[model samples]
Target chain A: MREVFQQSLREVQERLVKIAELVEDAIENATSAFGNSDVAIAEKVIDDVEEIEALAAELDLHAIDILARQQPVASDLRLVVGALRMSASLERMADLAQHIAQLARYRYPESAIPKGLTKTFVRMAALDVEMAAKLVELLRTQELDVVAEIRDLDDDLDELHAKVFEKVLSDKLANNPTGVVDATLASRYHERFGDHAVSVAKQMQFFLSGSLD
Target chain B: MREVFQQSLREVQERLVKIAELVEDAIENATSAFGNSDVAIAEKVIDDVEEIEALAAELDLHAIDILARQQPVASDLRLVVGALRMSASLERMADLAQHIAQLARYRYPESAIPKGLTKTFVRMAALDVEMAAKLVELLRTQELDVVAEIRDLDDDLDELHAKVFEKVLSDKLANNPTGVVDATLASRYHERFGDHAVSVAKQMQFFLSGSLD
Candidate 1:
């Protein structure tokens, strides 16, 4: 029974890594789509989100099945519960990526990065992609250090989020109301993407350290 | 054993309803604060969010404890899992309320509702507060009717969300970049708050119907 529980745990971990990898791809494609006005890639990200959501739902069912059958106790039980949460976070990250891609799709041939804040957005998108990659790594390895790295990346993402606002509200873009709206939503999507990444990291932290603090 | 497990389920239900009531209050206070630029109420909402977070964590721990001790299966098990998801949604609703309140505080002495959009925001806030109230009732009664009501409210909220953007981008607010930024964020916050409420409703639906569909 113990060995069977351990095997189920491994399956949960593998599934989590699978979802994280898809989220990484989604964010990467979505950000690239946003940066270059790549409508095809944006559409691809948009379409792929449904698959991620389906997979997340499948993973959740699997987790619940494990709980009902194996009835894992102590740390084993926590591991299963944590998988449920990580799956939810990863699913949210995928949704945010879709939101970013939608921003690009909405703008069509027109660039979504606005006029003067291209660099800031590029940096923000990079941080998001980098964080998604690190999330994949963390879920695969459970390395505690990766948690700190994800948090630091989130700090950078937040600063860029604030910078996006600063530039949007400044006089330079005063006449560009559409730009202001697009930048606000896009920046928010990116920042939220980073936040969901951090949430996954924190769940991993709880699994590793046995406390969320 | 059966009685103890049933009692534990009751405990879970009570706790969820308790948390929902708190969430309803938070959104109510938050929207009021946003409308009136009442920094005091905004601060109150902000400060109370931590309590909601703490309660959510506590509820999560209690659900896990029940899982470990009772080893419930099937519907009973799903009930506990649903409780966990509901707690998460409620906690998120609290955070959105805090974000709305923070917007109010940030624009203290100045209404966060951009001129001409006051009625729209007020309507949106009303829907959020109403959804939250229905959430509390849904948790307390498990009445599936409330679920449909919540979805309808979310639809209205989404329309208002789009309307906010339309007005913000219109020529009337062309010069008010700050107003655009605030309206965008505040509208998003309120919309998300309604979304979370709908999420909780879905979880309850899952509990009652044995499927999330």
Candidate 2:
């Protein structure tokens, strides 16, 4: 019975890593799409969202099955429960990526964001993609350093988000109302993508260290 | 053992309902503060957020105990897992409410939103408070009809959110750039509050019906 439980637990972990990788891909593609104003890449990200959702659902059921059949306790039980949350968090990150893609798609040939502000958004996207890669590492290793790095990346994203707004509201640059709203919402999407990554990292850290903080 | 498990489960349910009620209160106070531009009420809501976070953590620990010690299966297992997710969704809802309060507090002595759009925001706040009340009921009842009602409320909120953006971008209205951004984010917070409520209702519905749709 213990062997079966361990086997199922390994399966859950492996699937979780796979989901993390997919989320990384989604972020990378979404950012590239946004930066390049490439509608095709954006469409691709949107198209691939269903697979991530399907995987999340499958992982959830597998976790529940382990809980029911193996009746894991202590660290093992925490692993199972935490998997459910991690999958949900990753799925949400994927959805945010898709939202970024949709923004690119909405504007098509014209960038969703204004030209003057594109450099900041491009930097934000790069930072986010780097953070997503770190998330894949954190999931696989469960290292505290990776978690800290993700937190720092989120801080940078937050600062970038603020800069985006600062530029938009500055009198030196003038964008129409539509540009203002789109830039505001897009910057928020990128920043929030990092926030979700941080939340997942915190959850994993809590599970491994037995500390909720 | 069975009686004790059921009793603990009951405690978990009671605490969850209490959290729901607190979230409802947070929404009420936050909106009142926003509508009246009352910094005091907004500060009260912000200060009280830790209580809700602490309650959510306690509920999570309690639910974990029920799972680890009781080894609940099938329906009981579903209830335990669902409680974890439901508590999370509720905690996030409360955070959104606190964010609303923070926005009000940030722009104290003046509304965060523009004067031209205050009436629309007032209406949105009222709808959000109504939706929060329904969330309390749904948590207590787990009724399918309540889930349907929450969905309708979210739709209404989405429409209101769109109206907010529309009004901001309209030619007639003249909001400064800061007003446009604040209104955009505040509308999004209210809309997301409802989205969380709907997600909680859907989780409960799935638990009762054993269908993931």
Candidate 3:
């Protein structure tokens, strides 16, 4: 029974990593699409979102099934619960990325964001992608240190967000009022990107402490 | 052992409701703070986020105990897993609200978003407040139907968002760029509010179905 449960738990974890990869891809695609004003990339992200959502729903079911069938205890229970919680957050991360894609599709051809802030935007996007990837690492290895590490990376994202505000908000708004809306929204998205990083951090904390206890 | 486990599970449920209430208030506080450009109100929200995170951690511990002590299967397992998933999502929702608040605080006083869009902004705020409140109802009652009701209410929010967008984006962007930005972010918050509602709906689905299976 324990072996069956462990196998099921491992399968859930592996599936979660796969889903995380899709989420990472979606955010990167959405970022590139927005920065380049590429509607095609945005549309592709939109098309893939349903599959992501379905995968998330399916994963949650499997976790719940493991918990129900195996009636796991302590660390085992923590593992399944953590997987379920992480999947929900990751699903939202995908939704947020597709949301960014929707914004890109909405603003295409005549880009609302100023061209000058592309560098900052790309940097923010890279941070979001890396956070998603590293979160998967943290989950797979269960290196409790990664809980704190995710927060440190989140702080870096916060710094990036602050840079966008100080460097781009004032600079870009003064030059072009129309672009200011997109600039601010893009900044908001980047900041939100940081919060998702924090979300993963919190999940890792629960996983670590729950298992340890 | 079953009785003792249920006691902690009950405490978890009660605490979950408390956190839900906190998230509800945070959404309202952040929305109006953004609308009024009140940094102090937004600051209060930022301060309270840690409390939300802590509550979530405590809830996880309680649920994990229930799982370990009871070795719950079938219906009990479903309820605990669902509670676990919902609490995690609720925590993220609170964090997101704080993210919005931080955005408000960071850009305060001099947002320059056109003052004319206050009505639209307020409408969005109310929608967020409504959705959060409804989600609380759905969770506490264990009513999938209530979750569906929240989903139905989102239709109204969607219409309002669409109408606001059509007016805000299509018209002369040069005249009220700030208003557009403010309204846009407000709408984003509202949309996220709806997304969280969907999350509650999904959790209810799992909770309701897990028992039946």
Taking the candidates in order, what DockQ does each have? 0.86, 0.56, 0.42
Model 1 regions lying over 4 Å from their true place: none
Interface RMSD of 3: 3.5
Which tens-of-lDDT digit does each residue in B15-60 have in candidate 2?
8889999999999999999888899999999878889999998999
**What are the per-residue Cα lDDT tens digits for candidate 2 across A123-155?**
998998898899889888878788889998999
Superior by TM-score: candidate 2 or candidate 3: 2
Best by lDDT: 1
On the 0 to 100 scale, the lDDT of residue B205 in model 3 is 73
| Models ranked on TM-score | 1, 2, 3
Worst 10 residues of 1 chain A by lDDT: A70-79
Against the true structure, what is each candidate's TM-score?
A: 0.98, 0.96, 0.83
Candidate 2 ranges beyond 4 A from true positions:
A173-175, B173-175
Ranking by lDDT: 1, 2, 3
- Candidate 2 docking: what grade? medium
lDDT, model 2, position A125: 87
Local accuracy of candidate 1 as per-residue lDDT tens digits, B27-100: 99999999998999999999999999999999999999998888888778888999988898899999999999
lDDT on C-alpha atoms for all candidate structures: 0.91, 0.87, 0.74
Where does model 3 exceed 4 Å of error? A111-113, A139-152, A174-178, A205-213, B28-49, B96-113, B140-144, B170-179, B209-213
The residue-by-residue lDDT of candidate 3 on A14-80, one tens digit each, is 8887887888788888888887889999999998877888998898889877766677765666667
**Candidate 1 per-residue lDDT over residues A48-134, each given as its tens digit:** 999999999999999999988888886678789989888988999999999999999999999988898999989998999999999
